[model samples]
Target: MIAALGLAELKLLLRNRTAATLAVLMPLAAGLYFALGVGGEDDSWTMVVTLQLLFSFGFTVYVTVTTALTARRQDLYLKRLRTGAASDVVVLTGILLPVVVLGLAQALVLLGVSMAAGAPLPTRPDLLVLALIGGAAISCAAGVCTSGLTGTAELAQITTAPFFFAMIIGGLMGMSGGEDAWVFLIPGGGLGTLTGAAWGGPTDHVLEALASVVAWTAVATALSTRFFRWDPRT
Candidate 1:
């Protein structure tokens, strides 16, 4: 029953033009644009993971966060789910599973494309997996935490500004071949560390990045549990 609802939500998301386009297609588009824009440099495994992280974070975190909040507000989707056999945890988990699966699939696709294009496979596949899993989880949880502050779905874009900016700025840092001390605190920066570990030697800073992710996830979970609303704020 819960699985059905989760699959239903995935279908609904696919049907929505803005949500589907951004969530599914936007990353591919960005990857193409970057691939072309950079003229397919002999980028490192770090670059490969960074590109995948770009997709997962931008689509799953930025786009999906607003979409979830708006779906709740406009369609009363959250409210309806709560009235069903689904418990709150079940509903949240189910709704998120689609995004999680999509993120994993997209990352794998990107990884395959990168390798087929002559890029080396990640020297450490485990680290790549860490980046994908940790980044996706953090993005989804952040979305839920962000949803509580959202008033409407249309405005989901606006409320998503801070996190999106943080992720982007952090990505930019990775591209510059250097990292900042504070970026270690950004959600995406954890991904950067994971990517760096995959493509190059360990930074000895791995624990800091993982710790940052754990802290953010803990806080987001606490906030979501306290403030997530089934009904529209009105």
Candidate 2:
């Protein structure tokens, strides 16, 4: 039952214009955007943008947009599935796993290509792993939470704008903070620290960074668990 639902979800996503574009084009575009945004710096700034890409996509695009899109269009199908052989947990996992798996796979592929093309390997592998897991989980939960608020598929684009802007600002500030007072308030600062640690952060810094992602995850997940709607708004 889980396998069947996963297959169906995959097919449905493949047929959507937005999902197809996001899955195929968003990563490369993000790489280019980050590269350009940071101006090919030799310092830790560039690393900041790279990890920002991972967090930004996981939260801004994947969690928020895709979840809302699926809920708006397929809520009926999803609600019905919950009543069948598949458990609610299985049904949600099937719908959500494809993008999460694809994102992780793509991140690995990008890491390999970046290394081949001269990027250095991560120094704090544990920190990097935490960011990947914590950040992605939060984003996924946030998406489910937001989907409960959305009214239609088309509205998703407009609804997701705030997160997109937040991510862009976060990425930019993350790359340019020079002990600026306002930097710590920016979520991207924590993300930058994590990315920097991935290049070998001090133990203290890595712990702090891990804490930030975990805090974010907790907040998003708590909200999602409380408010997420399983049925269509109509």
Which one is best on TM-score? Answer: 1
| Candidate 2 local lDDT, residue 68 | 39
lDDT of 2 by residue, 101-204 (tens): 66666666655555545566787677667656655665576666666666776666666556545544653454332145354354445555565556654344
Deviation in Å, model 2, residue 94 alpha carbon: 1.0
Candidate 1 C-alpha error for residue 11, in Å: 1.2
lDDT for predicted candidate 1 compared with the true structure: 0.70
lDDT of 1 by residue, 1-234 (tens): 668867987888888888888788888777655544542665544564586676766675556865766676567877787888878888777887887788778767766666666666667778767777777777787788777778777777887778876776665554333356687667677677767677764657677777766876787778877866777777
* Clashing pairs for predicted structure model 2, backbone only: 123-198
Query: Weakest 10 consecutive residues, lDDT, candidate 1?
Result: 171-180
Query: Model 2 scores what on Cα lDDT?
Result: 0.59
